[model samples]
Target: MAVYEKVKRAIEQMVGDKSSEFKVCVEDTRGTLGGILIKIEDVKTQEISAFRINEGDEGEAEHMTMYSVDTMLQRRKAEGIARLEEIERVLGIKFEKWQREYILSRGLGYPIGGRRTGRTLAHQVKTLMKSKDDIIIYPNQRWTYLDEPERMRNSERYAQGYVKKLRELSEKLRNHGINVPRVIEVDDPQAEFLTKRMNLPARRGDGMR
Candidate 1:
């Protein structure tokens, strides 16, 4: 059996009788790095067509390299040193390899000051509202939020940030003569929003205060 036929049949079996009104197309792509592209779609509704492609598989993944702990650590250290050297060379700023300092990482959600993407909040909102695609991918966007205890502080800060963003967006729209909500309401504006302790992620980063 051909590779494409095998993949198509496997998908059909996975979907069972539901795939009766659907089509799965697979094509072998040629080049230096060869692979197959698989596309699946519903023939009736054409609502969703999720497709995926595979690049070249160089070797048997089951026998992939598993380096020793010592070797892995050494390799990581070397890579870090090389990166620091490259940064210093580009910026002409010296960094002592041994000297390290911890800084509170505030860059969790949005880009700092929203200056990185160059795409303004207004533009983003307009684009989102105008988009009619069945599937829209959000890069650097998180779907689920993990709210934590009041002591953790990361959780409630996001809500506050969200309010701030809404206010900013409203102001931007108002500037463009687009009347949006004048007031954005929320529960407990000043208090520390609390959550159950069981949901805490098992992370040891900087020791949660």
Candidate 2:
């Protein structure tokens, strides 16, 4: 018999007369090494239990045992309750209801990429605030002046302005109970290079030549 069929029969036997209350589903994880997720849902109570059975050597009968399946279900139920409690404490709303409202209220934006850039700084700060850490400030690549002396001088001025804005933002977040790190300007190679570039005289005019 197929592994899925055997598991399904085992689950049915475990649920007994209350089998109608549960629904079983299998999802394939598409990749070179195939894996599958088995989910059992309590339709009446809207509770879900799941387990992953990866492609490998295993005694399937052992995992499909009534004791093993029941234990897994109980553990999943406990975890779900805990997660719901955490969500309630943080947002003062049940996760299921909040999820429904959130989905309806806003359009899901594009997926975030792994690489951090200046454009994603605001999002990064928001994520940091969600954590328990005192503060975190991740600075990405330094601004490139592209050999323009005047632009290099302007970049320094811009950096100062950026620091001021960061401080203000941090203060605002602190007022809202979000602790953020102090924004400090450090003397780095980029700053030193810009300073030297700013002092260099402009090249001779080609118009005169």
Best lDDT among the predictions, by candidate number: 2
lDDT of 1 by residue, 1-209 (tens): 25445544544554455445456565556553355544455443353333334444312111111112223334534644554344335435553322211111112222233333422332223222222222111111111111222323445555455445544654565465542333233244222222124553222111112
TM-score, structure 2 vs. true:
0.29
- Candidate 2's displacement at residue 168, Å, is 60
Runs in model 1 deviating more than 4 A are 32-34, 47-209
lDDT of 1: 0.35
How far residue 181's Cα lies from its native spot in candidate 1, in Å, is: 39
lDDT of 2 by residue, 84-107 (tens): 354344444443443323322212
User: Each model's TM-score?
Assistant: 0.22, 0.29
| Candidate 2 structure lDDT | 0.45
The residue pairs that clash in candidate 2, if any, are none
